[model samples]
Each structure stands twice: as C-alpha cells, then as structure tokens.
Target chain A: MAELFISISIWPWLAYTLAGLVQVTLIVTLVAVGALVFIWLERKVSGRIQDRLGPTRVGGRFGWLQTLADGLKLLTKEDLMPEGADEFLFRIAPYVSFCASLTAFLAIPFAGGSYPFVALHMNTAVFFVLAVLGLEVFGVILAGYSSASKWSLFGAMREAAQVVSYEVPLGMCAVVPVLLAGSMDLVVIGDRQTGTFWNWYLFHDPFTFITFWVYFTCATASVNRAPFDLAEAESELVAGFHTEYSGLRWSFFFMAEYGSMLAVSLLASILFLGGWNGPIPVASLLGLTFENGFWLGFAGNVLGTANLIGKGVAGVTVMMWVRWTLPRLRIDQVITTCLKYCVPIAASMFVGATLWQYAFPNGAIFPQSAAAYQVREPWNAKAEAKSAEAARVEKTASREPVATEFTSGRTAEAAPLSARTPDPAG
Target chain B: MEAPIYWPTFFFLLFSAIACAFAVAVVVTPNIVRMAFYLVLSLAATAGLFFLAGADFVGAMQLMIYVGGTLVLLVFGVMLTSQDRFISMKTSGFELGVAVTLGVCLFVVLAYCARSIPEWHGMKAKQVSAVPLEPTAAPLGMGLLGARVDGPDRSGYLLVFEIISVHLLVVLVGAAYLARARGKKNLLVE
Candidate 1:
C-alpha cells in the first residue's frame, strides 16, 4: 500500500505515514464500533439472562441504537470535577487507560497468513500485548489517587493487589501455549493449531484442556469482570476509580474496559481456540490458499478474519455468561483463587504439558495435522539430525577396527604426538 | 526531488527527546506521585529507544519489569505514604550542589566510555541501514538453555540462569520469613 502511494508520486515517508494512518483508523473504528455493539449486547444478554426485555424502546424493538443514545447522552452531560481532585491526573486518566488498551491491538493479528491483519508485526507479540495491557492499571491507579476520595483509593488498592496476583497464573497459563507452539509469535502459535477443532491447544492434552479453564479464570480476574471485580464492586465502592469522572471522560473508561475485554478474548482465542482457522477448515477444503492464486488467498484471509472475530465475540459472550451466572467473589476469595488455586493448578498443568510434549512429540491420542508438526524450527531439527549422524559415525568407527583386519595388522593403538605431526620443513 | 526521511533516526530523536525531558521532569516535579508518573514515561521512552536500537526482547523486558512492575510498586508505595508532608521535599543548597557535581561526574564518565568505541564513531549511514533487525528472542532463549545458536558451540548462560533462579528462591523465602506474623502460634485455641 505504501509502495502504491509512493509510485503515484507521494513522498516515501508520507506514503508510509498514510498507510499507517489507514491501519490506525481501521483499528480505531473496530474498537469504537465494537464498544457500541458490545454495550448493547451486554444489556441484552443481562436482560435475557434475567428473563426481561432490555432497551426495547430505543432504536427499534431490539433497541439497536441504545448504546448510541447512551453515548450521545454521555457526550452532552456536564463534565464534573470534584473540588479536591487533582485536575491534570483526573483529566488524563481515562485517555491513559484507553490508549494503553488500544496500543495492545497493534500486536494482535486478526488474521493469520503471510500477510497477517495486524498494525505491528511483532515477533514477541504475546509478550508485547501482555506488557501493554498491564499498563492499563496505571491509569486506574492514577485516577484513584487523584480523585481524593476514600472509595476511589480503596478501589485502586484492591485493583493493584488483584491484578498483580493474577498476572502470575495468567502468565503461566499463557506460556503453556507458547511452549506448545515453540514460539512467542501469535501467528506461529495460531498456525500451529490449523486444520481441525481437535488441533486447538485447548484439546491438545488433558493438561492443556485444564490449562484453558485456568487461563480463562485468570483472564476474567485480570480484566476485572464481575465475580472478581473487587475494584468496582458497585455495591461497595460506588463507581470505583472513575467515581469522580463525568461525561466523555467517564465513558472512556468503559471503552477501555470493553476494548481490553475484546483484546484478551482475541488473545485467548488465538492461544487456545484455533485462532483464524475454523473447526471445519472450510476455506482450506474449498482450496482457498495462497498456493492457488492471489484472489483465493485474499478470500482465505477474509474468511480467517471473520473466523477470528467470531471466536473473540464468542469468548466475550461466554465471559458475560459467567459474569451473570456466578455470584461475585469477596476480595479475599478473589486473591485466594489466584494465589492458592489458579497458581498451583496452572503451574502443575504447565509441568504436565511439558511432560506430555516429551512423551509424544507427534501428539498422543489425537494426531496433529502434518503441517502443524512440521512448523518446528528447521534449524533446530537439522542440528539434532547432524548430531545424531555424528554419533552414529563415531560408534561405527569404534567398532569397524574390531570387525575387520588391515593387511599390515598393526595393533590399533594411539600414535605418539611427535610421529603423527608433519615436519614443518616439508 | 526531496530527500527521503530516515524514520529510524527520526524516531530515535523523538524517543530520546521525550526520555531526557521526562527524566528532568522527574527531578523537577514537586508531587511525589507526579514524579513517579514522569519516571514511568521516561523509562517507557527509554524502552522505545531500545526498540529503535533493535533490542526488542530487552525493550519488552524494560516495559514489563521496570516501567510496569517496579514503577507500579513505586507509585503504590507513594500513594500509601501520600501525606502532604511527604509529597514534596525541600533540598538544601549545599546538597543540591553536591548532587549536581556527582551527577555531572558520572555523566562525563559515561560520555567518555560511549565515545571510546571507534567503530561506532566511524559508522556510515549505509552501514547502519544495511543491518537487518532480526528477532533475537529465539537465539537468546537458546543461549539461556545452554545452546550457542548465534556462534560456535561454547558454554552458554544455563548455569548462570540456574544460579539466579536459586538466588531468587532464597530471597523469596527470606522475605516470607521476615514478613510472617509474630503471634500466630495456637491460633485454634486463641
């Protein structure tokens, strides 16, 4: 795209900048539009779960424009500032949260192929995404401190403790997929789970199956959803860190929250749920691949993008389901769940998965697709093969002298160093 | 035709400017919490500089461990102890002078050492642009696991990694012991 613009006489830098802006605009649109839809979905889901009609009067019978109405209301509302609040930090907090959450999308590939749909093609994308997501907590902490309210301070402190504790188990569970894929690159991890539903890391083994649930539990807590959302605990802390925020500023926190929810769900899908590849492999079955033609490849990429988004949305819907189904956990219970249960379970599963991989390099019960197994680094395999051949030669060499006799028949003994050395004068 | 912009250099200048400016902001800021925030920005910009230098793994590590983990704790501590009395400190003139002198001396040493690299001094733009930014995580992971993928086979950092792990374990145990409650015996009876 940059090259096309440059060819049309635009300056090279400007062309590149334009290309970047296009990608950024697309991602921003996804986040904003996704937020609009998700807020409506959340209401609809919550209402359906409670056996009631939700937002029936807004934009039709289904209230399709309910979120838009809410957004407009939020925009026009008076922006309030508490007398004691730190003006600067109070103002910047929501943006900080939103930006950190949005930055994480840069490394998340929405489609997997030679040309992946991602803003930044990072090798350590998993690490990068996780790191950036962690920064979102800073905004909450700043908001809480700046609010000068007891509830906000308490909310922030709980958030700090909860997030810090949850990250340990979360990272452990995440590493299981990385270990299985043998790469931190999200594309590689996703590509490793191509072909069939059974090929997904969630179904890789007993350990991975268990690891998936643990990962989801940790993910839910990490994202500060209901049941583990001690930070907000609406009944207790009022509105939590954003209690003092009003108007669009307050809405930014919700946008950040929903954006991160999508981000982590997408990450989970990529890590454990086969990513852009569907359960049925419809695209591949229809001969839609880069090998066929550019159009076919483009079609495959489109299918992949839809597959990934569907999986992400499904993951979010499941999170909403869990939120509505379960009673909220106490703060102590949340911490205990992370430290005592999730940490130990994730650790054991990690160890078990490692052992399973060692026992079955080509997979155990369910056979992996040939392409998946072959994606292991060729250099590493080559080095091992080379070492094995060298060992075989050494073993045969040691036995060859014993099996056959030479014409001279001198005993096989070490030659003196001086005798073996060639004369320098010669 | 206009000369093409060198993006890496442009980003390098942008990151360095933010990093240096924020580092100074951290020292000059009166509020402790604001100082912590400035420090976070400064360290994050330094991480950006690391990325520009083609050290992606180190840059991510810098963001995760330093800016995310350590600074979060620093800010938490500041928030916990955030009385107005502790928010700002008034430094004495003599102490400021002494600190500036020490800072300047350290800066001079660092500058001298950086300038001592002859290859860095003579490197041309073409030479700089020719180097590809290959992902170092795989090789770094291999090296940590006792394989020298980037060079001739030799001793790698596996032993060092083990030693550090054990050292960290000891520190964790020590911390746990120190932080344990004192009056915890016969809790059921109590």
Candidate 2:
C-alpha cells in the first residue's frame, strides 16, 4: 500500500508513515471494540450462569449499550491516587500494560498469508507475541507496588509469580504446533492447517490433542482469568493490583486483560484449531483463495477475518463461562498447578509430540486412516535446491585455474556469496 | 534524483537514542524500583534496535529473557525489599563521581574502537538495498541443532548448547537452595 502511494506523487516517508498510522488505528479500534463487546458478553454470560438477568434496559433489549454506558461512567468518575503512592509509577503503570497488550497484536496475523491484515509482518511472530505478552506482568507488579497497599502488593506478587511460571508451559504448548509446522511463522503455521477441520493441529496427533487442553489451561492462567486469577481474588485482595486505580486508569487495566485474553484465544485458534480456516474449507471450496482474482482473494480474506474473530469470541465466551463456573485457586495451588502439573504435563506432551512426529512424519495416527490434509511442501525448497546447485558450481569454479582471475577483486569470483545466490521469489 | 531519507537509519537512530537515554536514567535513578523500570525501558529499546538490525530472533529473545524475565525478577526483588527507609538509598558523592569518570572513559574508548573499523563506518546504499530481509529463525534453529546452514562453513553450536542447558539446570537448583526457608534464628542473623 505504501509502495502504491509512493508510486504516485506522495513522498516515500509520508506514505510509509501514513500506512503505519492506518494500521495502528485499525488494531487499536479492534482492541477497543473487542473489549467493549467482550465486557457485555461476560456480564450476560455470567448473569445467565448465576441464574439472574444480566442487563436488558441499557440499549434496547439485551443491554447492548451497557459497556458504553459503563465507559461513560468511568470517564466521568474522579481519578484517585493513594496519598503514599509513587506518583510516577502509579500514573504510567496502566499505559505500560496497555501498550504491551497492544504491541503483541502487531505480530499477530488476523488472516493468513503475506497481506495487509497484520500490522507488522514479523518472521518470529510466535516468539514475539509471547515475549510482549509476558511484559504485561510489569504493569501489574508496578501498579501493586506503587499502590502502597498491602493487598495490592500481595496481589501483584501472586500475579507476577503465576504469570512467570505459567509462561513456561504456555510457551511449550505453543511450540507443539511450531514443531508440527516447520517454520515459527504464525501464518505458515495457520496455513499448514488449512483444508479441513481434521487437519487442525489439535487433531494432528494424540499429544497435540492433549496439548490443546494444556495450552488453553496455561493460556487462561497466563491471561489471569478465573480459576487462576489469584492476582485479583476479591475475597482476599479486594481488587488486586488495580485496587488503588479508579475511573479511566482502572478501565485501562481491564482493557489490557480482555485484550490479552482475546489475543491468546486468537493465538490458540491459529496454533491448534485451524486459524481463519473454518471446520469446512468454505472459501477454498467456493474457489475464493488467493490464487483466484484480486477481488475474490480479498473476499476470501474477509471471510477468514470473520472466521478468526468468531473463533476468538467463542474462546473468550468459554473463558467467561469458566470464570463464573469455577472457584479461583489459592496462590499455592496456582504455583503447584504451574510447576508440578502443567510443566511436567507440557514437557511430556512435547516429548511425546516430537516422537510422534518422528514416527509418523505424515501425521498419520492410524495406519488405515488417511492423513486429514496433505502437507504443503515448504515454500523455500526450490530456493534451497537452487542455492545448493549454485554452491556446487561456485566450488567447481573456485577449484579451476580460473580462480586466480578473481584475485584482482574485479571478477565475478570476487562477488559475495549473497550476490551469487538467486532469490526464488524475485 | 536526490536519495530519499533512509527510514531504516532514522528508526535506528530513534531506537538508539531511547535506549541510551534510558540506560543513563537507570544509572542516575536512586530508587531501586524506578531503576528497574528504567532498565526495562532501556532493554526494550535495545530490543527495538535488534529488530531494526534484522536480528528478529535475537531481539525477541532479548525481550523475553532480559526485559521480561530478568527485569520482572529484579522488580520482584525490589518490591520484596522495599521498605520506606530502604526504597531510596543515596549514593556517596565520591562513589558517584568515580563511577561517572570510569563510565565516560569506557565510553570514549569503546566509541574510538568502533570508529576505527573501516567496514563498520557505513555501507553503500546499493549494497544495503541488495541485502534481503529474510527470516533468520530457521537458520538459528538449525545452528542450535548443530548445523550452521546459513554459512558456507557449516560448524554448529551443539556443544555450547548442551553446556548452557546443564548450566541452567545447576543455576535453577542452586537458586532454589539459596531461596529455601531456614529456621527463624538463621533468618534473623542473616
């Protein structure tokens, strides 16, 4: 898009900056709208689970505008800070958390392939998302410490411990799909699972099936949802790290939490469930893949975006249901689950999955059962073969007496290896 | 036509400035918690530099391990030990002066050495533009698995990798031992 703008009369810098701004704006709007909808959904889900009416009168039936109303109320409320609080840390904590959550989305592809859907097309997007997601703990810890309240401090401590420990298993579980797919690129990972529902990584093998559950559990803990939300146990810590925050500042923390929950759910869908790809290959069957014309490809991507969003919403709704249904764990129990149970289970599954992949490289669980989907040969195979052929030629060239002709540094032999290697894409 | 403003260099400068400024802030800050926060900013900016330099894997590793993991641990330590009196410990004037002098000396020497390298000065725009920004994750993985496929000479890091794994295990056990609860008398004495 920037290149298109640059091809016109626009300045290159201006075009690039504008393109970035547009992407950032889109992602920010997505998070804001996602948070609003999820909040309403959570309230309705929780209310139903608890045998009570959620909200019905706010904006017509079902209180569709309840979150908006709440946002206005929060905006109007007075901002409060404790007398003994660290002023600087107290003010910046929420933004730090929110920024971390927002940044993680930069690497996440809403729809697969090299397109304008992702804000930043990172190669190691899985690791990048995991890294940025972990940074959210800093904001919680800072908020807890700067609150100058014992409850807040305790909550922050638990949150830090729980999030840090849970990251191990969460990362391990995520790596299962990365192992199944050759590349760490989330797009490739998602693309590999295309074709059918059975082709999803969740059904790739017994280990991966188990891994999906473990990943969900760890992801739930990592995002600090219920059953593992020792960080904000109301009965114990009042409101945990955000106890001292009020009004807009308080809402930012909630936004960060909901954003991360959605992000992880989206990640899970991409990793285990066929991301963007539905149970059935609707778009592909309709002949709307990228191989089709530009308009059809765009339509396919639109459909994919909807599919991914739907899966993410379903995942969040399930989280809300679990939050209302189960009791929160104690701090010790949380630690125990992470260390004793999750870590070991994830480790065994990782090993098992690796072995399973080794034994059944074609993803066949049973000899009689056909593989769900044919694995796409890696995109770089031809490039690698070409490079090897070039290397062999270069070796032969170097061995000949003509190699001395390159000593003056003006011959083709003096060119760097990079110059010799052909780019398949180019 | 006049060459367009190099955006990569612009971003590199921006990230480097943030990183250096925050690093100085970390050193200057008296409060341990604030120092930790500044350190996080510094390290994060450094990670941005890594990304700008096209070392995405290393950059992500730095963010995850250094900024996220280690700094979180540091903040946890600061919080645990942060009593009102202990929150802001004043450095002695002599110590501060000496540290600044040494730091400046080291900076000058390092900067001089960096500038002394001929090839490091700058790359031709043509050469820079010719380089591909391909993903380094596959080569990095292969290198760790003891196959250096990126380079013509295919040496690997399997030995170093194994040694690091064993070292991490030892550190984990040692840390657990060090943090283990002792009797009340021993705790009071410590």
Top candidate, metric DockQ: 2
- Alpha-carbon interface RMSD for all candidates, in angstroms: 11.0, 9.0
Error of 2 at B38 (Å): 0.5
Q: Report the error of model 1 at residue B184, Å.
A: 9.7
Model 1's CAPRI class is acceptable
The alpha-carbon lDDT assigned to residue A381 of candidate 2 equals: 33
TM-scores for all predictions: 0.89, 0.90
lDDT of 1 by residue, A153-261 (tens): 8898888878877888988999999988877899888888889899999999999999999999898898899988898988999988878888999999999999999
Query: lDDT of all the models against the reference?
Result: 0.83, 0.83
lDDT of 1 at B158: 66
Candidate 1: tens digits of C-alpha lDDT, residues B60-112: 88988887788888887777667662367778889878998999899999999
The segments of candidate 1 whose C-alpha lies over 4 angstroms from its true place after superposition are: A1-9, A373-426, B1-3, B84-86, B180-190
In model 1, pairs of residues that clash are none
- lDDT tens digits by residue: candidate 2, A1-426: 677678887877898888888889988998999999999999999999999999999999999999999999999999999999989999999999999999999988878744536777777899999999999999999899888898999999998888889999999998999887766778878887777788888888899999999999999999999998998999999999999999999999999999999999999999999898899989889988767777787788889989998999999999998999999888899999999999999999999998987676665853312322222222233333445653444344432212211221122223343343333357
